[model samples]
Target chain A: MAMSTASRVRRQLPTSPWLFAAPGLLIIGAFILYPFVSTLVNAFTDRRTLIPGRFVGLANFRELLQDDMFWVGLRNSTLYVVGVVPALVVLPLLLALLVQKNIPGITFFRSAFYTPVVASIVVVGLIWVWLLDERGLVNSLLETIGVGRVGFLSDQWLLLLSAMAVTVWKGLGYYMIIYLAALANVPRELHEAAAVDGAGAIRRFLTVTVPAVRSTMVLVGALSSVAAFKVFSEVYLMAGPSGGPAGEDTTLVMLVQRTGTGLTGRVGYASAISVVVFVVTVALMLLVLRADRRDES
Target chain B: MSVMEKVRPTASRPRTDAREPRVTDENGRRVRVGELVLRYLLLLAVLALTVGPFVWQLSTSLKGPTEDIFSSPPKFLPGDPTLHNYERVADTIPVWDYALNSLKVAAANVATNCVGSALAGYALARLRYRGRRAATLAFVLAMLVPVEGIIIAQFTTMRELGLNNTLIGVVLPGCVSALNVLLMRNAFLNLPYEIEEAAYVDGANVWQRFLRIAVPSVKGTLAVVAIFAFMGAWDDFLWPLIVLSDPSKFTLTIGLNYLHGTFANDERLVAAGTIIAVAPLIALFACLQRYFFRGVGEGAVKG
Candidate 1:
């Protein structure tokens, strides 16, 4: 039997790899690739809104250019991406180093930090709403300290800040876990060598730990940037579907969903918004990758 | 030199003994005490930041209906703790039905991901056949496009297939998570080819070799993938909200939103509903904490 098998193997019959790959590839084609192309195609054709309009060349794009809400969302999203990326990159590294040691109950701390990531956005939003309400815990605490009630989810700037805070809170542990893995891989000898050279704790961390995790820094930074662009649930659930008062906290995804599903129901226009979002995200990723390559070179 | 004391303890020993003088110098003993104090102070502050709100929610959820949730001074504990809020939530909505719907979607996702991603990942990693490079490229590109960006079109596609308003609609798009496939592919690539070769020499064909040999070798990656798929499905809201409109077909997340809408005036009931929605996920994460962290790190490092 073994000889027969060896003989058959010698012939090297061609078995189609596609047979194994077909299911996943089919799903991707049906769900992602096809939709992506359809979105691009739909951006030019007004199908769902107002008398099933025809292919209006550049009309949706033209309107998107003129729309004030689009610009508001774009500005808010840009601000969000700028504000959240640095915290995700830096704070998580600090937290990761803090818990990297095998101290007693360190695992509990890690899990505590990670619990928010597992919870639904609805839950996170609900909890924050209660905590940030005028008479809520935070405001009450501030009042006790002689400060006035701060509108975390009402005042425009505060609303944006509150949204950013939630993202940072939920994401810190996830990036920390990634950094922990990278920290584990950093050579222990480097720290020892730094110590032997009389480098202080801060200096050793600066020279040894920071440089070792640079690649992780870029990865986390880039992922966080994409997340900032794709942020919807937090804003949607927190600010209601309209994205808070006057759509102050509206994100790009929120714009897309609102346009596509609301009473107006402009599918083509929503596709345009999504295309713009996709382009912006891809551009951010490319910029990140370019910088990474430059560092490598 | 005292900083070197912070080096990871050697893995051979179970306990990292505090008395170990691995980094002790002339002034090490005195400095170590301060260092440990500062370290725990910082950890405690962070612990409070992350876990504080959840603890607050738990307290609020247990508070009686008439208890002042928004008192002048913040109340950290419930004045009169009761099961009234939970009972109220259960009375208001079909809580168990929503939980079952969420479980159904999550189970289908796990099943599809385990079978589909594993097979595709194996083929991608091990086989050198036609269109392999193209398929790999397609998967990578697919991963870059966030699902939110293409959701409208995806919804339409689901409608075209008559899957809208069904649990399958929510599960179909996520059946093959590109990250999960990449993880499994990396796992398969890390395995030695000698085993597969030996199986071939013993008359085992592709399917037999894959099922009997390759599959068993990457159980860790499979478990990680399964956990991620389950979590994604369970916590999903937007897709199910868009797909299923019927209250009977609503998942836990949608149900929670509906509960919030109905009980808008009652903060305690809303708090109770949020806890019910969040508890299972926290429990799952607690049980699978090892895999959850490992999976995040694995995806990050490899990608």
Candidate 2:
């Protein structure tokens, strides 16, 4: 029986890899790949709103390049990618390191920090809206501290800042977990060796600790960057229908939603934005993948 | 070196050599004091920003109906807290029905995503298959590309299948979470193959082997997938909003969203309903925090 099984495996390993992969492959093709290609192709056509319209040419792309809203959306997304991604990357690592201690009641603090990450984006946004309202606790706290009230959600600059703040807050627990898992993989023996060498704490961290978790850092950073691009519900909840004060908090995803479903209703126009978002995200990923792969080799 | 100096590292230098005596110098003594204060201050800032809102929300939920929520110096602590808002919220919507509906959809969704993830992940990790890597990467890439177009198409598909406004409608769309697939696959790949082979040698079937061996080994990953699946399904609003326009069939999420307009945006009622809707997730999360940690860290936006 064992011999027969061994022979069967030998035969199967060589020729059957593709055959076993069909069902899932088909779903991927139908749902993911096809939609992506169709979306890009549809971008070039003249689709009237949510209705089925005819194909036009590069006119959609031309309009996308010329439209001022598209530019604003692009610039805001860029700021978010720059602002939120790094904070998501850094703050979480710091928190994980802090909470990794075995101090009394530290577990409770860890649990509290992570609770927000599990909450829905809409819920978080709604809470943040109340928190940022003119007479909100944030302002009250500021007033108590003798700082005059400043609009956290209304001023355009502060709105983007608040959006990023919420983005960071929701993500802090998540990235901390990533950083925790990554930290777990660092062998205890290495730390002991660094300790034996009279290496100061900073020296040990820089030389041994940081290097061990480099892969995780790359992986976590890249994933968070992509997440920042897909950020939708937060903006929807905070900014209401238009993406936030003066559209400053609008992300690439919000723009796609607005163009696809709302008064704009231009399917081709929205498809063009989708294509652009798709490209931008792909570009961000390629950059990270290339850098990480290069580091690996 | 002084005893206090030997414990905490200076702020500018965060590294604490587990073995080496902590760094100390005559001129740097005052500098260390300032750095220590700054580090604690920054950590305090993080705590205040992150947990402060929940405290305020709790306070607001306790406020009376006519109490000014949008006030001059927004009352952090209501002068008089009451359960009147909670009572009204319970009256406004069938809270139990909404809760049950949410549980039903969320549980069914989690079960489907789990079984789907297990089968798909098993096939990807162990079964000899054609274009497996490419297929896996395709799913990963799909997640990266915008799904706005597909939502409309999903709506169209649901309409065509007569699945709209049904629990199955929500569960079907969630059946194949690609990120869950990647997580399970990565977990399975890391597991020792010898266990499965030993089961194979004993004439155990593939499904039995998976149940006995692979499943037990990847319990952590499964827990992670289950938690996120429940959270994602329970909190989903857009699909339910788009598919079911009827209030009777509404999920808890849609009902909470409805609370605002239903009560004419009465601040207290909305606050009460929002508090009710968000409370369980926060509670469930507190009970099962580790799974969420694993899921978030395991989130894959890569191909």
Candidate 3:
């Protein structure tokens, strides 16, 4: 009887939340938090394989400001983020709307659009290289139309565009599904009401549909921009290690990966590059968030 | 407003006619000629841009080196398509071996990540004890910390564990993915808790309650988690390249990199091997595209 009453008393107590949280906290702290801190410190040091020797302070940062390769990589990364994020946001929305209707063979259409998302970036890159080679199918098709062959994954001017193209292709399905879901969540009666108002479908889309999915567009745009910023696998794989032919396709991430983990053990310099990337990404995210909030207001 | 007022139909029928908006059909569609042409043109352009490379890959992979892919007019299709390049890429490297290695690593990673995530997710979801809010915060924060930042520390850890040159290193750091854990947590949170409590009262332990009640309820989440884990493990190049130095231990992703080293600028074999490497993913996603999207969208929403 005493034990039963004691159990009742125990039941009255609030649950301790720490028991469930500790495991996740411990692992993340070790792997993520610690490393991020170490990288910040590493930004102040010379390129050392094991440990830093002297305090370089802002020397690395100063050098980075003047580094031509750094500027090129940053410029490429920015241009890529600009070019690719728009396609990622827009193409998927278009695809999602086109196929969200209960057309015959909708599943086939969906899969055809989504299959690229599943394929490995490395494979996509390699495959595209052949396809865009001077004698590739695209050029041959163009030749059939009397357009001369142009290097798709090569040529300094087109290299990043090729990477952006593949990025948009491989990732469109993911955001398409997001769009599909948002589109589904839209109350169907809203469309009907608009139709009842004698409004055409185009007016309904602009007035009702677009605003309804504004949050999703904001989200997809932000995430896509971030992914573009870290455009590593495709850039490295499609474009050569030296950032395509003659450094035309280099991004900040590529520079960090190549210089940090390549033949040289410039972990510090690479970490510095990583630091710059982290700052830029965070800054972009903040800017987007601010603009979004402002728009919301 | 001005344009609408100008274009408002002033016919005998009232403007509020209940007639269906036939905007989609070729006849009912009143899209301006310019916009209609632009729409189809843009659609075709994106489609060509998207599918063009794959078509080229298919054609080039079949062509012989003598039939240059870089010819001025570019070969849309191989004159006499051959499996010679495929055979060459397969012969040049241990293609099957690398593929198997990729499968094994991906399998182990999927299994470990799924189990770890499910257990942790349940623990956080229904077993509210203390610090639950803090855990969620940490997970969100952890999500922002990119792979580039932690890769260095993870490398050190692998070296310390003497697993740097093994597949274990390639798979272990990713075993406890925060993203998957949070995904499962959200999924589990969406599940009704009373059923789990009923199991709890029936003398079932936490594991039994989880296995019996939670797993079946969120199998969609599990499958999606599995696909993500599998793809992440499969497509991961940098981690494997960093950890596994031996050629024999190369995963398909790393093996692709090996092609870069071996054939610096040789496009044909690399293209062939690339196609081979990613073929299964293409097939798998083709089979489960909807579920994968269900997972990705929910994954993004919760994330």
Candidate 4:
């Protein structure tokens, strides 16, 4: 078998491997790699939808320095990372511990929890939009409790907060599963040892469970922070395409989409914003990984 | 000890029947009744939070126009349940046609991802040739390139090809994702080399070995790739919104966005529209949850 296999391997056509990889290579090259290169190139050129632009050489970047909307976009996107990451990193861990057992109907509960993750962000956003509307269910419930409806969508800050909450709600199950996998690898003996040492549930969790799942927490933090920074659809759907009252809720990606499309889109400027997004995401990844390493020592 | 014995049947030593009221934790120890109740209460609360919005939407969709949906102490159940809003949504927009468009894009994405990734994965994993490392590097780099950052360039590329405002343009950029390619590669790598050696000895060509021997073994990963591709395409808003300009070619997500924008006042109509968009996906998830969980586990471990 070995001899025949060797001979057949030698006899295989050289072009066959290329043939197998061609379609994938072609599609990604044309769609992903090529576009990525062009995004970098266009960041320097004063490009638009209908016009091929000349090299502008940092003019777009210089304009980004003074753009108020760019500042708003930056502030909001950064705030999203801050507002959403810790909750995602922590809540999902608690949730994973809740359903980690082999209890009856746990599968149903797990699947149910994941329902939000399965639904499109558009649907999730719209549902929240209606739910938080002045005459919506949540407001009605609030009024019944004698608390008048507070404007969730109308207020710019509240709008950002609501979108963050929706993001966390949608993300809980996904990170829960990740934490569950991490939690399983945690040895039962450690919990037993902690119990025998008279550590209560909270003590055992803080000393035992948290440390055990710290790496997974970092992983969740990294993923969620990056995703939160790039948030567009939820804010777009909730706050409208113009991005809420005075466009205060506009995220960086929403800015990218807003500026980069249409007949008179400033592609060059949008590409510069996109470059900022890319840099920040890469920095976020490195920062998390660095934090993880620092914690190790 | 008594509690432990009650939860764990002594007769069945190894195989614990799921229906036999076994309530042991993962370590096979009895969870105290108080703790179990607390856990359950927390689970129910979360379930309400997670699944409640969807249920409320469904109820709102069923509410008749005469029923005050916004009544304080909001009605949990729709009085005189009706599907009138669903009909109204269709009249308001070409919802079914948009759904069909989404289905076409999603189906095409699934096909391209599965076939393209499998072929590329086989080459990267099994068939050794020149520039294999570079090819692998290409996919890895491609996977790292964030799609959100390149929308303008992609739109321009599509326009340069004169494919903008078309469904094909909507399907083209993400039809064969690099992430799925790497996923397939990892799956193929995990398979034992000796499984395909016998086929090689039998003079089976690479295609035959891949099709008959390799492909069958990696069906789980293929299913994962297919499901994710379908969901990604279906749930996608930004790309489809950017690529397709014609309202006639709008995917369900973009169509729903249009509906929400145009008729933000009528909550019932918007609620009904969301349900139509989400219910099929939820049903799909319900039926294939086993695969979904497994996929999540595998992805987390590998990622």
**DockQ scores of the candidates:** 0.58, 0.25, 0.33, 0.76
**Which of candidates 2 and 4 reaches a greater DockQ?**
4
Give the DockQ-based CAPRI class for model 3.
acceptable
Winner on TM-score (1 vs 3): 1
* TM-score on alpha carbons, each prediction: 0.92, 0.81, 0.85, 0.96
Once superposed on the true structure, which residue ranges of model 1 sit more than 4 Å away at CA?
A1-16, A49-53, A196-198, A262-264, A293-297, B1-31
What would you estimate as the lDDT of candidate 3? Answer: 0.75
Q: Which stretches of candidate 4 lie over 4 Å from their true place?
A: A1-11, B1-22, B301-303
Given the true complex, what DockQ would model 2 score?
A: 0.25
Q: What are the fnat scores of the candidates, in the order listed?
A: 0.68, 0.26, 0.41, 0.90
Q: How does model 1 score by TM-score?
A: 0.92
Query: What TM-score does chain B get in every candidate?
Result: 0.89, 0.83, 0.85, 0.92
The window of 10 residues in a row where model 3 chain B has the poorest summed lDDT is B21-30
Instruction: Tell me the tens digit of each residue's lDDT in model 2 across A45-146.
Output: 876544666878888989988888888788888888898887876778778766664443556777777777777666677787777777776787688788
Give residue A130's error in model 3 in angstroms: 1.5
* Residue B209 CA displacement from its true place in model 2, Å: 3.1
Which pairs of residues collide in candidate 4? none
User: After superposition, which runs of candidate 3 have C-alpha atoms over 4 Å from their true positions?
Assistant: A1-27, A52-54, A152-154, A196-201, B1-52, B63-82, B264-268
lDDT of 1: 0.85
Model 4 agreement with the true structure over A1-297: per-residue lDDT tens digits: 678756666677578999999999999999999999999999999999999999999999999999999999999999999999999999999998888898888989988999998999999999999999989989999999999999999999999999999999999999998898899999876887788789998999999999998888888888888898899988999899999999999999999999999999999989999999999999999999999999999
Better of 1 and 3 by lDDT: 1
Q: For candidate 3, what's the RMSD? A: 5.6
Give the top-scoring candidate (lDDT).
4
Query: Number of the top candidate by TM-score?
Result: 4
Chain A accuracy of model 4 expressed as TM-score: 0.97
